[model samples]
Target: LGRWINPDPGGTIDGLNLFRMVSNNPLTLRDRSGLRGSGYIYVPFLSRDTVDIAIALYTQKYAVNKKPDIVVFSSRNEQLDFYEELKKRRSDFAAAMGKSLFEKYNTSDLSRKSLLNAGVKETEIKSTIMSIGNYLAINSMTLMNQQDDEIFSEISIGDKLKIIGHGSAGSAEISSGGLKSVTLSMHELAERLDFSGLPDQALQITLLPCQSGDELLEPVFIEGKSPFMRTRPSAAESLFYEMQARGYRRVTTAGYRGFGQIRGFLESTGSHHTQRKPNSITASDDIVRRRDAKEIFC
Candidate 1:
């Protein structure tokens, strides 16, 4: 886990002694960087059909020697589409904040002491504050549109579900489900899934659907009005907040902004669609993917 030079002090310099150290079992164990010691889960809802293409693209990208585990599930009802509503809300918030202030918080640095006081790591302060101001803007706007049972869907859990793998980090490639996908909520999956099989350590959650990084107001009432203007900017933020709120310290969540896709491939079917900001203005698929692939963590 330390400096990954040759594990053997004395051996032929063939450049692959670490793989030999793990006995070639990188599935349950990995010596690589980024998310070391953490396996990934790629869960795709079965009904979308188009999501399969995205899954294939993802599998090709991430499935090297240590292949990601795939879990196929299905949903009965078509998930609600909240993209337009959220986009409108965000645009309005941006307008209210004005372009200059919006750009400042959205892409610039925040008060270092304030972020550190909020318990952000020193190294992550700069990166973490990029969207905190956007989240704050959306959170303020969402307070006016509060309603009963607004945080979760009334629909019952879907049937014909099959869960597999024990990945410390999960990437659910949701297509139909907006934020509160009908197939499953972030809380529902975390609570229902049996993650006890994994090592007793932190877990990371990722939602791969478009606009999964947008903000949503939390549904908690106090004296007929929500006390704290709490909001979840993405599925990952929701999971991270839930984990911390429910006293699970060792969990983190991440989601992509604008349109998310696996690099270098067209994941969508022939059905034509467009967005105000498609993550990137570039025309190339790979460039769009790279630009669109910015993840907002919580």
Candidate 2:
């Protein structure tokens, strides 16, 4: 699990790794009107197939303004392994998948025309188009794996939080002053930390293997639905509702997940590895937080 500031927050070309879940395009400009202020982006990695790496841009119409935050959670080693495999297969995979996607969803001509009208350089337009194709191919692959356990989960936030109460099993809460983080192990289970105290700031939350199971559990409140509640809120929804109750008006989440097995190959190829105590879960505070995409990608 990791989190970082989106170098291009609210920009159209952000969240490339999340190409699996969100279309590699900007949210409709019309929808942008309803945003009250900036929100935090949180990304979680629960399983290989359940990784949905995209930024969750939040805004409120009539609430206290707050800076956006980003959170990511995943099996670190597993995600790294999957990425290594993807890199090895990228060229072949892109070539095979790119054509079909391009033909079906290609907007190159329209995009080029728009860029030309906007006075963008020809080279930049070409580069952007190429990036679009790559993103389309990746999105196609993600759609194919929607049913697979190795795909990432889709997360969204909306106004109003409907809460009932916290469940008794596999739940924990960590609170410091008015800020709180919760871990819920139900329906695929997830861990979330709230930073209502810090406005317009970004922080990363990494969950180590040692932090898994009952040891990570703490008593916490779980929101429930009322008689009018027809749909169950997802983990993200529940967390957003909880945050709003704590006086936060905006939120966002984004990140990627692992897909293939390549860790062993990397290890054999002389990749540096870190050693940790057996079955020991590292405390959340001790986990290093990445500050930018460069650090994460490099």
Candidate 3:
């Protein structure tokens, strides 16, 4: 395959594959909502470059003042690997310990007092539970520090974290493997990430995925009857809500409900159902939190 230069190369996000769509493995990898084409199949959206989108975000949101603390270009393979390994570890831990105990450790505080009260030792708990940063570093494909296993053992991600990946309404799709592929749920991700070290009202997390900001209508079944009416937060919203529930306050999370795309230097502000109109530059963080036709920040 012939290589192509990205049209909008200003402040391109990462050094990996700056000019390739689907990581130049167009035959296998699936790029959804974030990119335009794979091989000869030219989709009629915007640029098929995730780097372009990330650059737009950076130019508009974080780079104006200081560079983002952590920028994660989460590839499908790495996401899948992390999800699979995390899932395996969860299952294995649950098996070794009881399901209830595992749930308590993950849900309840792992503080010394809490662990002691629960008849668990801090040393044993830490030994059994693998550090998430270590897993991410070991499995990362893009830029990641191999020594983060120790660097982030007790610390949370710094102020800002930007993740660009294939997303859906409810989860970050980790694979192009469709149903057989793994997915990381919003709640699971929120629970797994370390957020305890962030200063009050300082953490900012941005997620670029299709309809990741759209809310869901969960039917409230009553006596197994009809006319059940209820609504719930979208995946991104749930992530924020989960963070709040876990005592992280004043943290901002950004996501998009539309099929987010970029044309040249501007982000496509058009809604999901209609053709994108790139008339103005809308920064990802500046997007208004809405159910449709815009971005959501919570």
Q: What is the C-alpha RMSD of each candidate to the true structure, in Å?
A: 20.2, 20.7, 22.5
Of candidates 2 and 1, the better by lDDT? 1
Model 1, position 213: C-alpha lDDT score:
53
By TM-score, the best candidate is 3
Q: List the residue pairs that clash in candidate 1.
A: none
At residue 297, candidate 3 shows an lDDT of 56
Model 1 TM-score, 2 decimals: 0.39
Best by lDDT: 3
Worst 10 residues of 2 by lDDT: 55-64
Sequence-dependent TM-score of model 3? 0.40
Clashes of 1: 0
Q: lDDT tens string, model 2, 1-298?
A: 1222233332333332322112334343334424332222222333322222221111111111233322222345544554554465456545654565545435444552354345454554444444443343333232111122221233232221111112221133211111233333322222223321233122121221111112222344446833332233232333334545555443432111111111221122232112222232564332222111101110
The model with the greater TM-score, 1 or 3, is: 3
Per-residue lDDT over 203-255 for candidate 3, one digit per residue giving the tens place of the 0 to 100 score: 45556556666665666767757767666565577777777877766566767
Rate residue 186 of model 3 by lDDT: 62
Error of model 2, residue 15, in angstroms: 25
Model-by-model lDDT, in order? Answer: 0.38, 0.29, 0.42
Model 1 misplacement above 4 A: 1-39, 50-54, 62-181, 194-200, 216-232, 263-293, 296-298
